[model samples]
Target: MPLHKVVYLANNTKLYLWKITEDLEELYNEVKLKDSSISRLDGMKSESHKKGFLAVRKLLQHIDYNDFDLYYDVHGKPNLKPQACGIKEMHISISHSHGFSAIALSDKNIGIDIEILKEKILKIAPKFMNLSHLDNLTEEEKIKKATVIWGIKESIFKIKNETGISFPNHIFEEDFNFEDKKAFAKLKFNNKLEDFKVQFDSFEDYMFVCAFQN
Candidate 1:
């Protein structure tokens, strides 16, 4: 399918998920791209990567914006250019896994991430989060929750867009149950403190998280 799902995350925030069912040619022919986007697409070495890039543009068009309106900063963060007349700025974040690509947009600054459930995250749990947070859960639940926590930290990093923000030392997620599907986190870096409201859900064996700056 094309646009697999649309999630209304908050009053001004929304998420879009695209399941990669179309082939390279099909997706490429579906959307209009700027010259820069076309060059970027041509330089991609893999069809999967090309599909993800094109699929993101599809999602942008779904919301009445196109690739021309999107740009990346020196920090490699994706941003949107204002339309003819606008006073508000829209924050956007993008993520892609093996079989899916997603984008989230909101009037408020936000970040998002999606990850395929895998055991490798279990191996690196200590590198990015508190191991104690995974206590009292089956091995399966542990993997799921750990993946969620990883996504939370990644989303938080995307929102902050600052250099030298170590995931293990700078971002901290509060304890919460997998059943709750939502949590909060704190980012302490450069002698400044900030908070975020995190929400996540599982789909097709992948977990996606959205973080709203607080």
Candidate 2:
């Protein structure tokens, strides 16, 4: 029930963030799930994952939607059931990390990611990011910046949602200072090049990133 924050993004997109502070029973009782979601929830072995799943449903209710209004496609991207009034098509993206879960909704395509900053990212930075982007920074800064970069790629991938897209090979973030909290990225794959505008900010020890195709 702790709705952490809401951010309004470009193109009428809205990002809802929830900090998981409820126990499994509390969240399960509060969230009304469709049969598919119930099955998905039952299949989640980790209590942490279950909590994240329920928290996202809570976010939907906060905006006057519910599990019945949500569905996933073959690509695993979330979608909103069109309203009877013939409103604009709504696109949704969902993400969760250790203690947080987030959903971004928009009339335009958007991707969002929330990641807890951790030192583990440092060891694998080269696998998913440009190592030179971390140079001339303290260890702590490296973790934060690297995690943000990883989140950037994740957000873009969610936007693209294409198979065979490699994090380090397909998506690349344009170098930007950590203080700015925003950057740009390019995706090159299948003989196509596309640009994306990235926006990110940190809350507590986690980073929330959003991407809009440009």
Candidate 3:
């Protein structure tokens, strides 16, 4: 399908989402991929992954960008080329879940993630988050909240994009209400404490989260 949704997370920052309704061939036929992307897509083991890869390229097109203008760092973080005529380079983060792909663009550094809600997060919560935060929440609420926390950590990691940052040990989220649609977190790594502002939303059994350095 075309662009699914656009969310303004902050001034000069936008999150673009694409709901994957098209088949693999349809998506592949729509987006033009560079040889590197084609090789990466060929190496993918699942059709779902290939569609998600192409869907992101489709999103780039929605914003007047194409796969040729995007590249990844040694750490696997996505980036956009410097704009023509001296326009500021845009920071980008890419994510895809079961049936959705998303890209966040901003003048400042940013990270984003999307995850499908499931009961399994609760079982693994203690490994990555403070379980006490899950108290007093219903089963459904726990799943939603836990998924948000997980996304928060993942987004933070993407922003930092460095070695030795542990989700449970280095990244931490302040307690947040599901209704607030925003939160705060800190990364305590390398004898430094860095703060982040987090924004998130839910749609169709999926939780989307983005983090900005504060």
Highest lDDT scorer: 3
| Tens-digit lDDT track of model 2 for 1-214 | 5689988776578899999999999989998999999999999999999999999999988888898889888999888889811468888899988799999988778999999989999999978988999989999999999988998899999988999999989998999998998899999999999999888998999999998898
Best by TM-score: 3
Query: Per-residue lDDT tens digits of candidate 1, residues 31-89?
Result: 99989889988898988888889889888888888888899999999999877116778
> For candidate 3, what's the RMSD?
1.1
Error of 3 at 108 (Å): 1.0
Which residue pairs in model 1 clash with each other? none
* Per-structure clash totals for the candidates: 0, 0, 0
Q: How many backbone clashes does candidate 2 have?
A: 0
Q: Arrange candidates by lDDT, descending.
A: 3, 1, 2
RMSD of 1: 1.5
- For candidate 3, give the lDDT of residue 191: 93
Arranged by TM-score with the best first, the candidates are 3, 2, 1
Residue 11's lDDT within candidate 3 is: 83
lDDT for model 3: 0.93
Point out where model 2 deviates above 4 Å.
Answer: 84-86
Give lDDT per model, in order: 0.91, 0.90, 0.93
Cα displacement (Å) at residue 205, model 2: 0.9
